[model samples]
Structures are given as C-alpha cells and as structure tokens.
Target: MSVSQPYPQTYPQQGAPAPAPGYAPQPGYPPQGQMPGQGPGPMPGQMPGGQMPGQFQGQPPVQPPRTPTMAGAAERPNLLHALASESTKLWTTRSTLWLLICATLSMPVVDFAISSHYAGLDQVLRSQFTTDSSISALTALLLYVPLGVMVITTEYSSGMIRNIFTACPRRARVLTAKTLMLFVGTLVTTTLLSALSLFVSHAMLPGNFGEPVANSDVLTTAFRCGIYLTLATMFSYGLGAILKRSAPAILIMMAAIFVPFVVAVVTGAAPGSLGEKLMDYSLISGLLSQFNPQDAPATGPSATGILIYLAIAAAAAIGGAYALVLTRDT
Candidate 1:
C-alpha cells in the first residue's frame, strides 16, 4: 500500500461550480474573463483593460430614402387648363352639343310661335303681368319643367352623369361648376336663339312684329328666359343626381310643382282651395319662377324670394346627394 497503483480519477476545479453532464458555456459571451477551458487573456504584455472603443459601437447605420417621384411633382394648373378640360368634355360628347342646340333652336321658336298663335296670351301676359307681377306668371305655366328634363335627365338616361361625377368627385363642386357651365352655355345658346327669334319675328311682322321699341320689353323677357332656363337646368341636374333616373324623378318634380295647382283646380269648391297656398312651397315652381327683371311678365313670388327658395332647394338636394354618396356602396 506504500506505492498506490495508478487510479482513474475525475474531480471539480477549485472555486468553480460543477456543471451537469451535458451542459457547456454559452456561445458569443465569455463567462467572466476568458471563461472556462479558454486560452489565456490578451496574452503577454497585453493591457489589463481594453484601451479603446470604436465609434457607433451600439448603433446601426442609417440609410437615405430613395424614391421615383417627389412631392409636388409636375406643375400646378391654371384656370384656362381647367376650362379647356371642361369644354373638351362639354363639346366632345355629341349629346351635350345636341341638347344645347335643341334647346337653343327650340325655345325661341316655341316662344314666338306660341305667342303669335295665341294672341290671347299677349293680352293675358300684359294684364296679369301688370296687375299681379309675380315670377310664377313669367315662366309661362309649367311647360318649362319638361324642357328641364332635357337639360339633365338625358345624362341620367345615358349614364353620362357618372362620368361627370367621376371627373368631379366633390358633388357640390361639380354642381357649382355645372351650374356655371349651364349659366354660360345657356347664355350663349339663348342669345343665339334670341337673335334668331328676333330676326324671324321682325321678318314675320316687320314694323309690328312685337317691334322692340325703346323699352318694348322683349329684351327683358329674353333675359328672364335665359336666367329661368339656367336655373331650370341646375334644378334638374340636382334632381338627376338624387334620383339617377329620369321617369320617376320627372314625375316627382312635375307633381311637386304642379300638383298643388291641379288639386286646387280639381277640388275648386272651398274658399280658393286650401292647396293653392301650398303652391308657394313648391321647389320646381320656385326655381322656374326666379328672376323677375321688372319689364318681364309678372308671376307669383318676387325674383328675390324665388331665388332664395331655389337656393334653399338646391342646398337641400346637394346635402341629400352628399349623404347618399358617402353612405352608398358606389
């Protein structure tokens, strides 16, 4: 026993916890210094502590943004560009110009012809115009409502209203633009019609064909006609947007304007029929009756009041339209 034979032996290192059988030091991070089973530190003559640190040791590199297009690309547009675009669309469609031409050529001829045919109308307009002087009298009954159907209902029929709405996303803006376009377009069209009508009337009755003497009032009638037509177009456009259909909307509009009067006429037993007063609330009648222009035939409601009503009706229609588009699927 004095010299023990060589014995197999294994033991833990001093001051270190023994690991379980399969465990090893984690990768990347050394234990405390050079860690277990590692070689000696910075070796001979190495500094005790690391001497220097590199810049941005704890951060990542920043990258610059690269884009194909920048903000405010191309150039801003001007008024001419906008108008040219509008006009291009306005005239490009054969239907638009056709409608314009139709209204232009039709109204004045109908005006002169009807007035000529019914000599009684002239006396009536003169007496009622001078006596009553309401805007309702000047639109010459409700015949103009059907004319308004041509103004915008055709767009509904042809689906051009969608294109118009697409180009003009904001309903009110497009409505405004359309109103302006209607005003301007009808201005030109009616002016031509007026000229043509005057020419024909003078030729027909020469020195007496409603001779437009100093303050003869033809100019007044013509101006009122133009304004009335423009308003009618705008009113119909709003209705088109709301209904997006012609027949039903047309019937509704007609009823809204004419029903009160009809109801009064049909049941004419009471003290001037209670429904007669309700006619004042009619939007179609109000719009068609706007703009008196003193010398023109008189009708119910002053131009100012009629215009106010038309504006209110337009605003309500526009609001309803906006709500519809916002909530609707398409």
Candidate 2:
C-alpha cells in the first residue's frame, strides 16, 4: 500500500490579535479578556487590582453586635420622670384636693370666728387675741401630716407601689422624690395660708394689732412657718415609709406632735423638772422656737432640734426602705 503525504498545518496570521495592549497571560488562563472558568473578565473600567471605579478597596472590618448591660440601665434613671409622676398623683387625688382646700380656708374661717367673738374686747385683749390667733395656722400641720402619710401609703394600699418600684427600682430615690414633692406642695400652701391669716387677722382686729408688712418679727415668723411645715411633712413622710401603713403612721405622727405637749401640760402644773424636760425636747416646742426664739421652751429643743430630729428620722426611714426594697421581692 502507498502512504499519503501529511498535509501542512496553518496558524493565525496576526498571532492571536497581539493579545490586546497591556495584557499578560497567566498560566492556565484563557486570555487577557477571559477568565479561567468564567465567561468574560470584569466589565470595562475595572482595574487589574480587582477594584471598580468609585469602589472601596478591600473588605470593611467586621464588628461585633452590641448587647445590653446593667450599667447602661442604671445610668438612665430619670429623676424628673419620678417628680412628674408624684406631682400628677398629688394633684389628681380627690382627698388631696379637698384637704388642700380645707387647709387654705380653715385659718381664715377660724380667725374670723375668733375675731367676731372678741369684737367687743378692749384693744389690749384684742391685741392679745391677734397674737394668740397666729397659732391657728399650726392647724394646717394636722392636715399636712395626714396628706404626707397618704402620699406613699395610698400607693402601698392600692398596690401601685409595685408599679412604682418597677418603674424606678431605686427605692430611696423614689421616696426622695415623693418627699420633695410633698415638701414643696406643703411649703407653698402653708406659707400662703399663714400669710393670709396674718393679714386677715390684722384687718379684722382692732387697734395696733395690725403689724407692718416689713416687720422683722412678722417676716421671720412667716419664713419659719414655711420651714416648720416642710419639716413636719418630711417627718410624716418618714413615718409613712417606715410604717408603710396609713393609720399607724398617722397615729404615730399625731402622738409625736401632741403627746409631748399633753405630757408637758399635765406635768407642767406639778413642781418637777420632768415636765420641763419633756417640754424642752418636744417637737412642737422646737417648732415654737422658730416663732419666738426668746420664748422657746427653756428645757425643750431649740430651732435646730426640729431639723436634727427630722433629718435623723428621714435618713433612717430611707435606709430601711432601701433595704426592704432590695432584699424583698415585689
């Protein structure tokens, strides 16, 4: 058999189109415009560095997600929120409204009745009556004590305290806000009522019983009355917190204000230093010192006594309340 001659093979005339400009062939790569296993290379405007125009380089660093922490929560307790809540509670209660109205009107009504009763008395008697009538303003303290007690006790009674605690787990902070609201409310109300009583008594009475508005004694007495009411309210608030019951707290507060006076009066008639000592440390006596520093009970607490006792009681109550709140379950 004869063997046929091998045919001559032909190749590209332009050497595979010159491999395009700036193109470099990588081992196993198809060509400059094609990928190893994919279709075309990156679209136009793409760089050899594998980045497109206006594209960021490389990948952004990954970040871990955030988580909640106790410190973050504790940092967000809002005192203003507590204040607003207490204020709303104070103004919205019917008992609070009625008690406030009575407190405001009681002084004027009682003073007017006293003045009318003594209208025919001589100037000396009338002046003495005017001086004595100032004590009627203290009557507001009776109402204020109950009001302060109810401020917290009502919440306890209705189980709203649980909600309050939930909203503000810092028990002492909650009590403090309530006390502040009570003090402010009582301060404004009692101060205005005392001033009004003074003005009305002077106007209704005869002779020089009407003192000048700028009288140092009158201004000092008015200022002291405000302080007296504020301290008394705080004292009652402490009692409420300590007792956590309205009736008991109210009874104890009343006893604190009146029992000493009763004992002092009953024993004062006898000849012994016991009665004198009781009168000296009495809360009312301390309050009286604010009105007449000179006439303050010779044996009883001074003006500073009121502050000292109230502060101690408030601090103790707050500590106890905090302990209970933290240790006890809702």
lDDT of 1 by residue, 1-330 (tens): 598779888787899876546546477665545545667555444443432233254444445686656545755544444455556756765656665556555644554554354444444343222122223223332333444444455665777668866855655554455455655875556545544554444334323445444334546544554555556555665676577666776687677766775675576525344654555445444434432334222334665566556656756765675677556633
The lowest-lDDT stretch of 10 consecutive residues in candidate 2 is 208-217
How much lDDT does each candidate structure score?
0.52, 0.73
Candidate 2's displacement at residue 271, Å, is 5.1
Off by over 4 Å in 2: 1-77, 209-211, 269-271, 304-307
Considering every candidate listed, which one attains the maximal lDDT? 2
- For all predicted structures, in order, the TM-scores are 0.53, 0.70
RMSD of each: 12.2, 9.8
RMSD of 2: 9.8
Could you say which candidate leads in TM-score? 2
